[model samples]
Target: TILLGITKASLATDSFLSAASFQETARVLTDAAIEGKQDSLAGLKENVIIGKLIPAATGLPRYRQLTVAVEGYKAREVDELDIAAS
Candidate 1:
């Protein structure tokens, strides 16, 4: 029935919009089924559907932290009037 609804919705309009709506519907249905219980890490859709951590980024074992350089040159302050006069 869910698949049928999704198929109909997809056919009725754009597939992308239908897909997003279907995902949201699936999430609501799944949440209702589990009665607000936490979802275990499973499929990508399930993780995303239930708002659990996705199986990418930090979930991966080989993930590395990125270091950013904070040091940079400071800009000199100039008056707007001086620039306009020039």
Candidate 2:
């Protein structure tokens, strides 16, 4: 997971700084998740929560931080960081 995260961060900081849009980012991420390139959106810890709503942490890292709350434990936070890190 960390690998993918680094790659994505690298891409954003080094290449897509001027061209990447949130919509585009979301689309790519979602597509990757749906396409099996990613394991699951349930692993990115930086944004995931097992039982709470992931607050809007603004800025670049937000796109990589994909948080998700578990079905039963909606109050806890789960970081699905493994989804795309590597």
Estimate the Cα RMSD of every predicted model relative to the unseen true structure: 14.2, 14.2
* Residue runs of model 1 more than 4 Å from their true location after superposition: 1-40, 61-86
lDDT for each residue of candidate 2 in 13-84, tens digit (9 for 90 to 100): 322321133326666556555766522223223234332223343323465455666688656433444433
lDDT tens per residue, model 1, 1-86? 35456555543432222344555667544645566544344545555554544466654434323333456955455443333344
Each candidate's lDDT (Cα)? Answer: 0.47, 0.41
Report the number of the highest-lDDT candidate: 1
Candidate 1, residue 32: Cα displacement in angstroms equals: 11
